[model samples]
Target: MNQEHDAGPGRSGVSRRNFLGGGLVAAAVTPLLTGQAEAKAAAAPTVDGVAQVTVRAAVNGSPVTVRVDPRATLLDTLRERLDLKGTKKGCDRGQCGACTVHVDGRRVLSCLTLAATTTGREVTTIEGLADGDRLHPMQQAFVEHDGLQCGFCTPGQIMSAVAMVDDEGGADSDDEIRERMSGNICRCSAYPRIVDAIRDAQQVMR
Candidate 1:
């Protein structure tokens, strides 16, 4: 016991000098290691443990490319990444029909569609429906007929109506318009006016 006390704490294999030296070494190297990790993350950020990717597509008649997570929904890519907020997100489960958009001339639920799948394809949102300062026929019809109240669901309704009219060569009657547009829901109960708008736009879209 006397000999150990004379040798001090170093007899236990770790001295105060060695402990302090190790701490200083760690402190000096920590910042460099942290900086390297930050650089790597900034270069290629990941999502859900999966690496992001570059997706290219034609949007609103223009070529567009975006870097996003592979699992990102088209709705998120449109509204968040590309800043195309005209396409609203409602009932993200594909039930509300608020995220309707045209893909290669056909209507699709953007909320249920993946951004990665749009590569090399054509995507048309409400923002693309206008030409210069003039609105699309469907858009004008909605305005003239008062087809919207709160206007939350107006974009999807207009998009679906445009595609429906084109697909059926015209809705023919109010009943047909209602049936074809059943997917889109208007919370303000603007069904009658929406039908009227579609019918009116049909004449011009043809």
Candidate 2:
């Protein structure tokens, strides 16, 4: 049966070389494939009324240069690209306080700021709030006062509180701290402990 099949007219001359030679035809088109891939990669993307520029920023005490889209929010730029997961994205439109970060020692809502405009400024997130082996005073206070329930918004809350206390925003009283930090809400409704932790941390930080 094998001999009869092999002896067939057009199949009589089947060889490894013939099969391999046919395969080379597809492989030879790889240059075309590569060109298309390059074209796709180099395709220009449209930018609206925004300028795209590279900025070198001191992030978390470390200098990093990144090409930022003018419309990209600071929260998305840091968490998605810079791998700063400590900054939460509670409300992308800046309603919640979960995306707070420090801009040159002052706390700002990262979800509302554009990444391109923050060039050359110091941007510090919750990841930058802690010291080596020792947590920041705010973090310690939060832990002591149980300021978190689900632990999702804790980083931004602590970071904002730290900046507030450092800036004497919490110097008035517990009510003042609560009012000042009202922008950063704890979804767990842990407002009392949050205020207490800020007050506690302010004393230690002073």
Candidate 3:
């Protein structure tokens, strides 16, 4: 005798094939849902319910007033908003001094500094180091000593070197220059020439 079997569903009111199909569908939909949520989150503007504010600051001896998000870094503000591209962004976490700039005549890591904090403060960038067609003393020294290899870190290195010479307890020797300027890392390993350049600039600056 032949027996008839119901292949549509089991006693649990669900078929094995249907169950697997539903599971696969759910798995695919989950990622889509998650991606949509992430996109929405990223598209949202306000940070912690605070909106962007207008910040007025002096950049390279020019007065600038710009609207920036509170969390925007000084590096981004300079490069993106103010159109100052000389300040290179290496390590945005402040580990590298490639984004160095002068804030009130003191060298500060622009990547780690907030744009809003620079309001009403004097900020100087690499472009400001030149007088008309003449390069700054430190910049001239860097070129003469071949202090840069790739030249990506040259701006920050020169900025720091200039500030170092102005400091009361700045580096007076090659070893001191290396130790003091250690925050700025040059992947090209141009330390020897960098030191030479800084020392030469120090005499010229003095």
Each model's total of backbone clashes: 0, 0, 0
Model 1 lDDT tens row, 55-165: 678889877766555666888788766778999989988998999999998999999898878988999999999998999999999999999999999999999988998
Model 3 deviation from the true structure expressed as Cα RMSD, one decimal place = 16.5
User: Cα deviation of 31 in candidate 3 (Å)?
Assistant: 38
* Regions of model 1 farther than 4 Å from truth: 1-45
Of 2 and 3, which scores higher on TM-score?
3
Colliding pairs, model 1: none
Pairs of residues at least 3 apart in sequence or in different chains that clash in candidate 2? none
lDDT, ranked from best to worst? 1, 3, 2
Higher-lDDT candidate among 1 and 3? 1
For candidate 1, the per-residue lDDT at 42 reads 39
**Model 3 TM-score?**
0.76
Q: Quantify how close model 1 is to the true structure by its C-alpha RMSD in Å.
A: 16.3
Model 3 steric clash total: 0
The TM-score leader among the candidates is 1
User: Positional deviation of 42 in candidate 3, in angstroms?
Assistant: 26
Please identify model 2 stretches exceeding 4 Å from their true place. 1-51
Per-residue lDDT of model 2, residues 1-206, tens digit only: 11222322235566523543311111211222122343343322223323344546788987776555555677877876677788998977788888999998998998888876787899999888778889988899999999889988888898888888786546678778877888888788988888888888898888
Inter-residue clash pairs, candidate 3: none
